[model samples]
Target: MEQMQIDPENLISIDFENGPYSKTIRTFRPDVYTEDGTYYALLGPDKATGILGSGAGPDEALLDWDKQLAVFISQKHSPDDPVAEFVFDTLGTSKKDVG
Candidate 1:
């Protein structure tokens, strides 16, 4: 079996904008090697509490992470609120999809 690895050099911070809100996201870079050739983007200390996204490549992983963030933000408001509706429309995913 192959082992998964992560490189400290891959750590990154990104400026994300959704609607009128702008925020920065810090990332724990995906494993350098994986059994399924998937890259996972992670935030927070562990999967249980962290936001996570996976894809075939790093960019896709990051985009998924952004969508996850949008879902997180939308949860703070009523579904019909403009901010909630805007993020759902822009990011296009639900909490289940992100987790």
Candidate 2:
């Protein structure tokens, strides 16, 4: 199972037509993989609070994932928490950076 490890900022949006409307969707970090030539994009854990998309390739999987993300958000569901905080109570050398 190969994983995507690029910076999240490089992700792009995919445009598609829905009925008589046009839409664009962009997704954040999603677990991407392929099984028997089918590509899948998954966010979070389960269907209740997560989104899953599949396609013939990586980009297509991401595009589908983005579309699903939009739908989930429209229903007032969040796939992942966006808030974060870290208390710096002491001065120390850090070997890694967050965000």
Candidate 3:
């Protein structure tokens, strides 16, 4: 897998189904805005291949690098914003098809 740092503004579009999927996962740190905005960070692989969902923080989702993609399908949480909803939806479908 490849890895690179990107400018947040330059990350306007993310096509996870493409070759960049492996390099498209990372932890997100959001900035405060009058209205909520969605941020996408790439998650890298460590050991496992499952998705992890946690509501332990305020309106935030974290996907572990080592977890299986299937683990994310079982998570239940309302996306705080549209971008997040899109990410979850795409991830869910991808995981299902791959499984």
Candidate 4:
């Protein structure tokens, strides 16, 4: 297996529109946005698989993202994959105040 490198210092923050957010998915809260009447989960950078999941409502969209995140982790994608890294980074940062 090819080794993947980790560049923690070089890691960058992902941008999401200041829209609705929810803590129902995983431990972290992913920003939710709507486009063309469909809600989407803003997972990471726009250029690379920006919107990971989409659905009719925020709850469904978040559910899809949670399932996608689990699949991504189970697949064991190379750490060099930005999409994977972005998903990890997004999930790692949780909203401390959320209950």
Which candidate wins on lDDT? 4
- Model 3's alpha-carbon lDDT is 0.33
RMSD of each: 11.0, 12.0, 12.7, 11.3
Give the per-residue lDDT of model 1 (tens digit) for 1-99: 112234555543333333222242332232322225676776544444455666786667776766876566645545444433434454564634322
**TM-scores vs. true structure, each candidate:** 0.44, 0.47, 0.23, 0.53
Ranking according to lDDT, highest score first = 4, 1, 2, 3
lDDT of candidates 1 onward, in order = 0.48, 0.47, 0.33, 0.52
lDDT per residue for candidate 2 within 19-96, as digits (tens), equals 222232221456666666777776554423456777887677877876775565444322233211111111131313
TM-score of 4: 0.53
Give candidate 4's error at residue 29 in angstroms.
1.6
lDDT of model 2 at position 2: 27
TM-score of 2: 0.47
Model with the higher lDDT, candidate 1 or 2: 1
Model 1 CA deviation exceeding 4 Å by range: 1-36, 76-99
Candidate 3, which segments miss by more than 4 Å at Cα? 1-68, 81-84, 91-99
| Candidate 2 ranges with C-alpha deviation above 4 Å | 1-27, 47-49, 77-99
Q: State candidate 1's TM-score.
A: 0.44
Which residue pairs collide, candidate 4? none
| Cα error, candidate 4, residue 31 (Å) | 1.6
